[model samples]
Target: MFKTIKNDLPASIVVFFVALPLCLGIALASGAPLFSGLIAGIIGGIVVGGLSGSKIGVSGPAAGLAAIVLTAIGTLGGYENFLVAVVLGGIIQILFGILKAGVIGYYFPSSVIKGMLTGIGIIIILKQIPHFFGYDADPEGDFAFFQVDGENTFSDLYKTLKFITPGSALIGFIGLGILILWEKVLSKKGKIFQLVQGPLVAVVVGIVFYAVTQSNEALSISQSHLVSVPVPEDTASFLGQFSFPNFSAITNPDIWIVAFTIALVASLETLLCVEATDRLDPHKNVTPTNRELLAQGTGNILSGLIGGLPITQVIVRSSANIQSGGVSKMSAIIHGFFLLISVILIPRLLNMIPLSVLAAILLVVGYKLAKPGLFKKMYDLGWKQWIPFNVTVLGIVFIDLLWGIGLGLAVGIVVILLKSYQNSHFLHIEDKSNGKHRISMTLAEEVTFFNKGAILKELDSLPRDTFLEINLLKTRYLDNDIIEILEDFLYKSKERNIDIKLVSKRGIVENPSSFIKFFNERPKSEMSLS
Candidate 1:
């Protein structure tokens, strides 16, 4: 950790700069006190980062959760009540880890993961356009159907045309240009360039521009466009930022509804992020899903306890962290420490940053995720890859994240099933030998309910005059669904002249018309999971 600190410190600084606006913007977007987002960021960085097994994953309050948070607040009649659910949601996540539910991340199809990254990329680009042009009527980082200020994200962008802040626009362009130059040119300038960060430079440039124009008309950014890290005058004012939950709201049915919403949505986002980030990882580091859940759960609980928004392992932040050369978990840990220290010590300094600079940062992040190369690469992999990948991208872009993933996964599964169904019929038998042909069925290892249709159809379709052999040599865990399919086939076989033989790890079960009865009759250890 110390060896990388020289490099990690600078990278963490960049992440800190990137995290600042998002914290405020997400808070504003979610209808919570702006400080709440910062709190969550701090907790996500310090608390969750410290505990997470992943070296590169970054946890924080997400734009995706804005809608749920907003609704939960109103539905539960107050923001404090919603915090209860967030805390509970965190606890639930910890339990999920305890139950080893982390493997759920592996279940997502690659196409869907690609689609999610692409869809998010598109969203960030669309969102940043207005911010890049000095339009921030709606809060930065809010990516929901509805905005905190009542206008939708696009509509707000459209509204930007009516109120262009020249100062904001100028700083945005210059900062973005600096960022581009830093990445394209200065980034190659030996160890120093690599050590010095782009986002940090962009943010500093943005601040200097703001300061120089503080007394001039050329400042395109106004007070509203600047980072609005809430300032506390005294100790009491600072302490007042932390709000406790109304435990009485815990009994409300709305509380449970909100809790469930937070739990499910946060969990889904975390799982999807885990999948997407794994793809983004150049090292191909596999994050432990259950550990991530546990880490997120712990973070959310800590965040909620401190009046922060709910937290998740966000893909956008994690991708940014990885792209910024975060090598170990120390970067995450340091970044979290950055969040904690910045908010407490120099929050007023943070308030000087313009939204445009942060927008520029995200614009770059969006591009990396949805780059043309990614599309071409997927296409080159062939239709099996392209179909699901494109489907996921389109689904996420035109519809939504969950829908796109669901649609892509569904399509991918169909492709797999189609492939399975086609491969399942090894031989097409039209003629019988010596009035009876010997036929054999070979089942794959651990055939689930998914393989039931293909396997059973192949077996049942065998002619009654045929000498049949049902093979389960490599088969493991033949679910009840498959058992029923075979049972039905066996019952129907009684009406034919078929001489059937069963071969399985359980030794054999000849003509199992009542397979369930016989299954129970056998030793429990012999029947259950190999």
Candidate 2:
């Protein structure tokens, strides 16, 4: 990890710039203390990054958990009481890690996962539009279709257009221009450009822009449109910002309910992010999922004890880390330290940077994730993959993150069942000289209850004067439900005057009186074709 510091240091700075506003925005959206978001960011980076198996994944306050945190805090009676639930949730996540529940991440369909990344990308782009124009009504990092402020995503954009801050819009455009030039033109020119990332340049330019325009009433960006970090007057007051959990709240049954909910949601979001970050990793490194969960659990526990919102492996920060050329976990750790040091020493300076600058940086990140090429790529994969992928993206855009994933997963499962039903058996029809129809049905390699419907349909469709051959020579396992279907079909075969030949690895039997008895009594070698 130390070997990559040359690359990691620069990348960490970029991630710090990216994570700072997000940490505050998510906290603002959650109705939690703004400083709590910074605490989660610090612990997520230092503690989780140290213990996690992921080289690129960065843990922090997740936008995905904002809604949950907001509601839980209200339900728990107070922010201090909510801290109790967060700590308990962390404990539960640790137990989940111990039980190796991280394997659940693998069960999600690839299409859905990709859809999630693309969906989130689109959401980022849409949500940042208002902020990019300096519309400060809706908090940054709130990605839900319906916002807590009673304004929807599109309505906020409309409102932003009506009340655009000239100073903010001007700086936002300048910041965007600098970022584009840095990436597309300047970076290739020299090492200096590469070391000094586009975002850092944009931030510096934004600060200068704000300072220069301060006296101009129409051009000056307001405090609402700037980065807001809690300014501590002295060291003691700075430390005073951290709050301890109300442990007595643990006795409340409601606290445990909230705890379990947080544990479940945070663990799921972390697992999904782990998978996404691994996919986004240029080196194709695979993260140990269980270890990630354990690390996150520990981070959440620490964060809660110190008055922080819940922590998860957030895709936003992780993606920013990867895109900014983060090569190791050190980048994440360094970024955490940056957050710690900046808040302590240069918070007022940080507060001077325009939110529009960060919005510009995130706009680029969002574009990368939801590039037009991805949609075309998914479409070319065929409906089996594309439908679920499209549904997931749409669901995430129109609804919330978890619900979108669930909707996509449900669609993916349905697609799998359809494929299973279709591939269960292959039918080949033959005509004999006597006008009798001969149908040969070959069972799939593995037969389960999902195949029962397809098999029964073919059996029931047999003509009155037909010969049916059911072949299972390729089958490895057959479900009891299918076996029962086959048994019941035998009685139907008699009424239809159909002669049945059941062929298996054991042997062949013709018009078996009792299908079960024939299979049970016959030895593999002794059975004869008759």
Cα lDDT of model 1 by residue, 1-530, tens digit: 67777756776776777778888888887889988998898888888888888877888888778877877788787888888998888888888889887888788878778878988888778778788878777777676545567776568778888877888888888888988998999989777888888888888888888888888866645777888888888779989999877777778877777777787778888888988887888888888888888888989888888799999887778878887888777787788888877767887888888888888898888898999898888888888889998888777655556777889999999998877666643544445678788887766655666776777667767766887777776665566787777677766777887776777666776665576675566567764434
Local distance difference test values of all predictions, in order:
0.80, 0.91
Q: Candidate 2, residue 342: CA error in Å?
A: 0.8
Most lDDT-accurate candidate:
2
**What shift in Å separates residue 315 of candidate 1 from its native position after superposition?**
1.5
Model 1 RMSD in Å is: 3.5
Tens-place lDDT per residue, model 2, 277-341, is: 88999999999999988999999999999999999999989998999999999999999999999
Candidate 2: C-alpha RMSD to true structure equals: 2.9
Question: Each model's TM-score?
Answer: 0.87, 0.95
Q: Model 2: which ten-residue window has the lowest total lDDT?
A: 521-530
lDDT of candidate 2?
0.91
